[model samples]
Target: MAFTLGSLVLLCGISGLLTGVWSATIVPVKGNNCPKGWTQLDCYCYIYEDERRTFADAENVCNILGGNLVSIHSDLENALVLELSEAGGVAPGGGIWIGLTDAVSEDDFMWTDGSNVDFTNFSGGEAGDDDGDCVAMVTDTGEWVDDICAIPLPYVCIRETFRH
Candidate 1:
């Protein structure tokens, strides 16, 4: 949707007389904007790295690829990522690192992307330990596990789908 400063000013100018009735065009973004080798989902792109790497190393790799570790916000997104990773044959007990971490404070997880963490899917007895600071998702259930940051594991990365 196109926004004009004049329109906003006019709306503000009329706020005293009006009772909150206004309208604006809502624009829809096109899909298929993710980079090659990344899967487009909503406005974000995701990729599952099969190679084992420490949480820090995985984050660095993601940074080099123009993104950070994936931060899941919904069940649908979690399921989608798990499906994609399972396509590469990750076993049930095997896990893939995500962006959640509590390295600074035990049991206080935060996303690397710096977005609001409104959703979480920690498994039973998980994310409660001080030693397990980093997070990984079990490929079979898409549930979370709190593991040490130094443990090597596969990981996922996500970034906004670029627009032309």
Candidate 2:
């Protein structure tokens, strides 16, 4: 019996298939580990923009990238976002627009994606501000702060890996 290169390759392939040794490619998940220029923590992708923009404009940019301003779900997620913002040189009290807003109803904060509110990181007496309707993350405390949606400020964008 002669074993040619092709035959060996075929046999190996078959063996792998039979033994289930071959697996599908594991594409990177956004929330788990984001791609270049994006940070991933669980299954969401986060991108921080150092340049300031109005809350609406920032959210538009995120939309162009197929994501929305970050909608935090847990403290861990909020912490990760805070870290990303800090790494980008966003100082404490520095504002970064997130997907949170109460534009729909005063004091009725909601994520831009229409996701129901699950968790919040509001600073002491933050959402109480009467002049603001949009939410931004304060790098100093990783707490939620309401600001005027039209005010330009650095912001973070978030999207699900499945969207991309």
Candidate 3:
């Protein structure tokens, strides 16, 4: 039987899934690497903004800085984010906006940077209960909760480390 291109692509997709060959969230950087104030992790760079702003406003700020709101893909990243928040002087139990949100389709969270939703560390019963659409990490506990998008909070931004 002759194999069509579509069938070949489908087979490759299924094979990748079965083999656990998924895409990576970190964007590889070259040359210059992260700026002086940004923290580098693997190939991605992150920066914590202490000023509080609404979710949309925070994202807009990140866009201006050449990145999007930070997306946590693993426990290590989450911990680092928590540490960053603390280092940035977030108040006890204060929240920091992350990139996860379900605004487009309620209860269906996605990263603002278009990364796959492969990992999550929400607190118990979170990402639900109609708590608006945005997500914020409780700085003191590193636990995540869905919250109102309009609420002002500090946030982190992530981007590929700068290049020459």
TM-scores for all candidates: the values are 0.78, 0.76, 0.78
CA displacement after TM-score superposition, residue 110 of candidate 3 (Å): 0.5
lDDT per residue (tens digit) for residues 1-164 in model 3: 34785586667778778989844333447555887799998889999999899999999999999999999999899999999999999988999999999999888889999999888888884565866799999987899898999999999999997665
Show where candidate 1 strays beyond 4 Å.
1-31
Instruction: Count clashing residue pairs per candidate.
Output: 0, 4, 0
Model 3 bad stretches (over 4 Å): 1-32
Ranking by lDDT: 3, 1, 2
Q: Candidate 3, overall lDDT?
A: 0.89
Task: Quantify how close model 3 is to the true structure by its C-alpha RMSD in Å.
Answer: 12.4
* C-alpha local distance difference test of each model: 0.86, 0.83, 0.89
- Model 3 scores worst on lDDT over the 10 consecutive residues at 22-31
Q: Give the clash total for candidate 3.
A: 0
Worst 10 residues of 2 by lDDT: 23-32
lDDT per residue, candidate 2, 1-164, as tens digits?
35695587677778778998854433445343465798766677888888899988998999998889889898898888889899999877787888998888898888988888889888884476658999888788888877888899988888876544
Error of 2 at 62 (Å): 0.3
Task: Give the least accurate 10-residue stretch of model 1, judged by summed lDDT.
Answer: 19-28
lDDT of 1 by residue, 63-152 (tens): 999999999999999998898789867888799999999888776778998987888998874565546889999887889988888999
Error of 1 at 131 (Å): 1.8
lDDT (Cα, 0-100) at 71 in candidate 2: 92
